[model samples]
Target: MTPNAASPLPPPAERRRLRESGSLTQDQLAKRLGIPSRTVNAWESGRTTPRGRKRKSYAALLAELSRSAAKVTVSLEKRPAAPEPAPAAAPLTPAQTFDALYAFCAPALVRQAYLLCGQRELARESVERAFQLAWQRWPEVAVDRDPAGWVRASAYEYALSPWHRFRPSHRHPEPPPPDADDRALMDVLLKLPPPYRRTLLLYDGVGLDLPETAAETEASTPATAGRLLHARETIARRLPELADPSVLHRRLAELASVERLNAPRPPAVRTGGERRSRFWTRAAIAFTVALIGTTTFTLRTAPTHYEAPVPAGVQVQGVPPRVALGPLSEAETQLRTKLRQAAAHGPERLLPVFR
Candidate 1:
């Protein structure tokens, strides 16, 4: 193809037509290209152009589309003209789109998250948080180049966050014990670095193809493949029995089985009601804090009357002239007032007292 004959990037309409001719949706094309559906949409909407590697992928996809179209044209020329195709169905609303994606993708995501974190509850939490984020940004996520990949990446990140380590983890129901070899493999897997482990899980455990794995991991295809190979080699070095591809595949299958058996059920989809409930719960907490703060400020500022102790044998004449213990020394009075304030407020508010 002449350089000028094929533009560096095809026009938006041509891209959209190519995808439609292939009977591929934006999400489908994104998955094939290891990109997000939103990227596909942006390219087709003339909002952005693919660059570098993506530009090359785009050109190749267009070429493939052209070849396929030519084949269809030749086949049609050999046969009678067909009836006109029907109009496409209307696009789904955001709610419908999210619900469809959730139903289709949540279970697999939970399993993937489980493999990453090794805790059933944490996996579920990660997937739920990811979906919640997706729901909040549905407009963008829905149009994403690979919606499932977008959510899966989010879930993976959530599972890896240091914060989850501090959260309590619920015990998962134990699966049937693994055989000796499986046990050994599990031990080795746990020792792998998180990136290698996650790549191995996505490619082998979850059965994602290299491109899909790359998209989920936010790595290029070559990078993801390298990680997978490194993980396998690492396993092989540690477990000589797995050096054989057949043995390694068997070990991977066993590991995948363990993940499937132990995977937590996907959490319920987040709804507006839950968000509202959370908002009210936060509001109640804020109100309680404000009330406590106001009460403490009032108490600290309230006047306190201090009575001086009379010394033994120090009686005065007629009415025992009231002896105000020489007004407490300036420093002592301030210290006493600060102590009261500290008691009324929290110790954290006692800078003056410490000074």
Candidate 2:
């Protein structure tokens, strides 16, 4: 066997099995191997045999991917059965449990958030905030069926929050990734609605199954399928070169890895959460005290009874306008002369004739 002599290819069925185990589509593997999909299809279908360095390279790549897949399987298999009430060893303390969880999930979560929002600092911030909240709710998190999922949901929410647009620091767009393909992918991703973007990333980029993706996205299975399909279609439309969704998936992973996003140490996160909680608690107590003081002061100094307040005076109304008298009437003049003679009497006035 010379360096150019390639080992016999696996049977067609085994070829498909290895590819599927690695969670790779034919187009993606073809792209990675820098060959056409039809060539890969032919090789997998047992239609052709090419004896050269290419065969050796293809077989080696497949072997590498298969080993990775196997490792993942073994790790999953090693997980303790969920129903076990107690383990042989004493249960880990809350801090240990939280730290383990944070270590396991935070790095990937930060990368995912960065892809979601395209902001490195914001992505780290979102994951930190999510872990902080998780620590505060440790009892709930500890007993959760999927603690990673809980933290992931919180991180995604924070990263994609519309309210972030109002933040002064986030007002302008951050610089895009340096590579052209990465820049294009980020632009397309940011254009998608939050739900569709999240669905696509979870299903394709994170390699989650349909049902798991649906559960994480909080959508019905059918709805999740629809979103995933539409998201692919939209991205394909925006970037015709990425019409093959397998390429899109590969590109997504590449883009996420391009940034050196990292999560803070778990201890720092835990302490930060404690400090934030304390500040809010102290603020709430101060507000309550101030409210109570104001109420007591108002009660002590308040008037004893409901004294009616005097209303402000209004201008007088109903008086007729004055008019000048031109001359005295004839009857008014005769009455005045009679009154000047001093002959007016109360008996005459009461029973006076009608003269």
Candidate 3:
């Protein structure tokens, strides 16, 4: 036999037509397409169809398969090229990052604050206030190891602040029903020192490891580890259910929903439009106060007394052209007498100038 006898034949659309007429399976199409059976199946079933560069290869294979059959031939053409993929979006800006981060952390911070303060609205307010501060300090925080932890710490501080703690809420949201177990655990955690609370929450709650936890709290690994160990042991003794992460998660989730743990929050201090508004408000108020003071002073200190010109006509003997004092002298007894008579007779009884 010649070497050419062993050579494989070309595939063509005629092979596909014959196969379809014969009701042959995708396995036969696979032989024709020179592809795996699954890919042929995908093509035939319309799950996917080849195009672009791959279509050229498919057409060549089909042509080769057609030549071997001899009974038919069909024109081969490649499919059009596939559309290009769209470009990816740009990365988030620093301000955008802060906003996203605040949104992600608000609910958690609120739950933590609630645990500490036992007031839902106060806790929410604390978290909102904390995010407001974090937004202002985003430059310092966005790069720092644990921005979320920093925000939570700030929230805790705000929750415990004397002013915030004592202030009454005139318009408070309805108090949510308490989860007894969560409140008990939170009670224990809240009683822990700030260092322990920071360490434990970063580790057990935020899922941070020792080094990251240490960085967040500005403590050494050993110190953070120690605090975490102590905190865990304390919590475990009080609430053994925390030993299982699942239980802890369920409890936390319940708290989170109520607190809106994941809600977007504002920055701590005024920035952007808020900053401009505060500045202009203070400036306007200052200007108004200054204008009022200036007006009052001008009205108060200005000389009130003035002389009308002596009416033309009637005679004046001697009386050395009367001087026009801006106001009457206090020491002149006659002036007092003239003031009293003027008051009694509505100025008609007072002696007049020559005219």
Candidate 4:
């Protein structure tokens, strides 16, 4: 890789731009990354930065863009979401809600993945992939009621997704033999349905008490207790070797630690003028695609909303508008009250805003 002549330490603005536009253009990437374009713009303008695992997510976008630049078949398209405002409000989509919740519970999820997969790369990838899927279909996700529970549920689903069962060859050419202990554990864990696996992992692997587990899983206390009892019995019956909960926890933790050590490094940076040029090149390509796609789509179907309806307003296309909330209708106030009551002591309690 030719190093850019830009400063070795990217300026705050540049790093922000790279992080927000790490994949491509701000708008295009916002669409692909399942975030609002304004959020992307905020990051690029150095108003905010992605935190924790979100940093890795931005890295993942860069990795994807790098791959797309090299591959001919790769294409980026905006996934559709509910129509609504120029700038979306908090809780833009179900996926965004999931993203926030997943970040909060990442520590436990990482630990669970470590135990189940026995390797750091597999565990982290599993988490990231699960979040990506949740982001893709946030609209239908039950997260409106319980975001953390939704993420925990989604994580297990991702772990058991058919694509995950067979390791991607580019990374694991000669995958471990099926009879390996880790492999055996993975097979057993994969057999459990999402609800059971989630309950079992949170209770046994993460060591959350039934009440805590219920809150995290969005299940009632009784339901959580029942699932835990049933999951333990089911595991013992199906995987007799794993009847020892101690052995199961130990193996899972071992796998997780192995994965932690081998985590993939994020991409490199260009310096000075080179950095600017690189940014422009990435932006140009994304712009070209956006222009073509928008033009073609618009010609095919005239947009209900005009690009620049107001004067002196700079309008951008290809980004979805935010959900609009008009003056609170009477029904809106009643629903808001119920929502506030339900969310009063739930995941929002663990979140920074609510805290």
Highest lDDT among the candidates is held by which one? 2
Judging by TM-score against the true structure, name the best candidate. 2
All-Cα superposition RMSD per candidate: 20.9, 12.5, 23.1, 38.9
- For model 1, which pairs clash? 36-144, 36-145, 36-146, 37-144, 37-145, 37-146, 38-143, 38-144, 38-145
Ordering by TM-score:
2, 1, 3, 4
Better of 1 and 4 by TM-score: 1
Please give the lDDT score for candidate 1: 0.74
Candidate 1 wrongly placed segments (more than 4 Å): 1-88, 162-168, 171-177, 203-230, 244-254, 257-267, 272-281, 284-355
Candidate 1 minimal-lDDT segment of 10 residues: 259-268
lDDT of 2 at 322: 80
Give the per-residue lDDT digits (tens) of candidate 2, residues 1-355: 3334345556677887889888898879878888756567767776665467778878887788678888999998998878566558887999999999999999889999999999999999999999999999999999999999999999999998999989999888888888988898899998989999999999877766677889888899999999989989998898988888668777887899999997899999999999999999999999999999999999999999899899999978998878877888999999989877875566557544896
TM per prediction: 0.51, 0.64, 0.44, 0.35
Model 3 alpha-carbon drift over 4 Å, by segment: 1-99, 137-150, 160-163, 166-177, 243-250, 258-355
Point out the worst 10-residue segment of candidate 3 by lDDT: 1-10
Pairs clashing in candidate 2? Answer: none
Model 4 scores a C-alpha lDDT of: 0.60
Model 2 TM: 0.64
